[model samples]
Target: MTLVLDKLGLARNGEVHLDGVSASFERGSLTTVLGRTLAGKTTLLRAIAGLQPIDSGRMERQGCEFGLLPPWRRDVAMVYQQFINYPHLSVFDNVAFPLRQRGVPDAEARSRTETALGMVGLSDFRARAPTALSGGQQQRVALARALVRRADILLLDEPLVNLDYKLREQLREEFRGLLTSQSDGIVIYNTTEPAEAMMLGDRIVVMHHGRILQAGSPKEVFERPANVAVAGIVNDPPMTILHGRLEDGRVTFGNDVGFPAPKHMDELSRGSYRFGIRATEILPSETGGVIGRVEFSEVSGSETFVHVVTPLGEAVMQLEGVHHVLTGSQMRLSFRPERLFAFNADGEGELVRAPTTGEY
Candidate 1:
């Protein structure tokens, strides 16, 4: 079912918010909503689920039944950041709560509860209280509850944020696999972390300041961010953007740094443009296109992030393999023209294929 959130707006007290916001999720695909805190991500989810009334705008669920309407009545289940299990209740009872509330027969509820717990590998802890469990286990119980309901549309709000990194990683893998198994439905998850969004989402909806900046596959958003804010958010080290100009059929970065202008950019009448290059595109070398001093280096075993203080500005590089370089070291880097990105000063971005730049 296509879930359309059209022109949604909301207000609370005297504060006005969400001006004409709209987006949608395709049936059966994992569409992860990405944004910073207070970007209206949660509000958007609540609006779609009909948990919060809107001031104006329509939420259209094509062909959905009304008796199947209300939050409990709809084929939807929400998993929150915190474990919402009844601490006094056993895991089994917690998982079975939804079924019991729905008035499912005792025999059927027992069977489904066990199945859901088993799916999350918590069948062994059925009788254990949530307070006795680890944070990860508690979250699993909440997930089990959602599964027992056999929801067609799973709405997850920061579901893994409360767990530690190790537990978060483990749960993320399991969650991805579990959600993947149910391809007949949809998983709409919200995440503030770019790395999590990259790993979990089949399609990413990037939001900033309560509006969607861009929406596409992981590669699409990463390689072709709609603007500078998005470019900085989606990548591991983020894309390196520099103020520059496309003049006389060439793109120049400050004084000595320049590249042949790709025909796509050349065709544009205006000469002013912004330059963007991913860290991988900037290789360290003595004879490369640009040279800079390494102001800072963050080496994380398998990879490194080098912040180069250059004549133009500081450019961050994401490099793989052991990093032997130290801060304050002079480094030279060059990027192929094709790997560079061109954008208008207003923050509109476009990817230029090597030897040719293409407009978005």
Candidate 2:
């Protein structure tokens, strides 16, 4: 089944919330919507679920059903960021609540509840009250409730935001796998973490200012962002954006900063353009590149991130291991022309050239 929206807009209390927002979701694939706070990610989900009224738009399930139905009758389940569980009820009871509301028999409801808890690895804690469980366990109980209902569509709004890092990582993986187990269902999630979306989503939908900036596979979006905002969001530590101009087949950022432009950009007029280079693409060089000073170095166990101040601008470089690169050390950084992404100041331009037939 598919969820369709046409020119959806939502206004609340005299405030224009969403403007001409349109998106469609297909069955059995995880679609992660990435948007910053206040960008209407949750609002869009709410509108689609019928939790909020649409100011002016049309939404429909593939069968043209759900024309006038509340959320409970629409077969759509949602999990919020906070764990909203009944403290006095056992995990089993909490999971069975939805089934009972639908008039399922007692034995069948119990069986479905057990199965749902098993999928989330919470079967052993089925008899415990919500208050006795840990934060992660309570969240699992909430998820089990949604699964027990066998929802036709699942909408998750930052569902793992309250858990710790290890639990969050594990649960996100499990949630993705569980969503795929249903052959006729769709799962739509909203998240701000690019890594999480890259890991869990089959397709990533980048949203900004209530509009979709780009939508593609993780590799496609990462390798070739559609705009500056998308390029900034897809990478960890983000892509370093520098202002420059193309002249004589070379990109000049400042007085001493110059690098050969990739051959793919040969067709563009020799004028101004912006460049985006991920931290992983900047290699530490002794010379033959732009000279810079290490303003600071952040060393994690497996890798070190160095922020360098250059005549052109501040550039962050990711290097493996801690090689005793001290702060204020004189260094040079080189750019990988193939790894660089270019965009125009107007925020609409080709991020990277498409690969040739023999390249891949």
Q: Identify the leading candidate in terms of lDDT.
A: 2
**CA lDDT, candidate 2, residue 277:** 86
| Candidate 2 structure quality by residue, lDDT tens digits, 1-360 | 788877788777777778888778888788999878777889888887889887787887866845357876777888888878988889899999989988999999888888888988888898899999889889888988877777888888888888878888787777677867743588888998898889889899888777788888888787778978887777777778888888998878877778787777787678877788889889988777788899998887678898999887899899987766789988989987766667885546546443232332
**Model 1 per-residue lDDT tens digits across residues 63-96:** 5532226765557888888778898899999999
Candidate 2 Cα deviation (angstroms), residue 291: 3.8
Candidate 2 minimal-lDDT segment of 10 residues: 351-360
**TM-score of predicted structure 2:** 0.90
Q: Give the clash count for each candidate.
A: 2, 0
Q: Please tell me which predicted candidate would have the highest TM-score against the true structure.
A: 2
Question: By TM-score, how accurate is candidate 1?
Answer: 0.86
Error (Å) of candidate 2 at residue 197 is 1.1
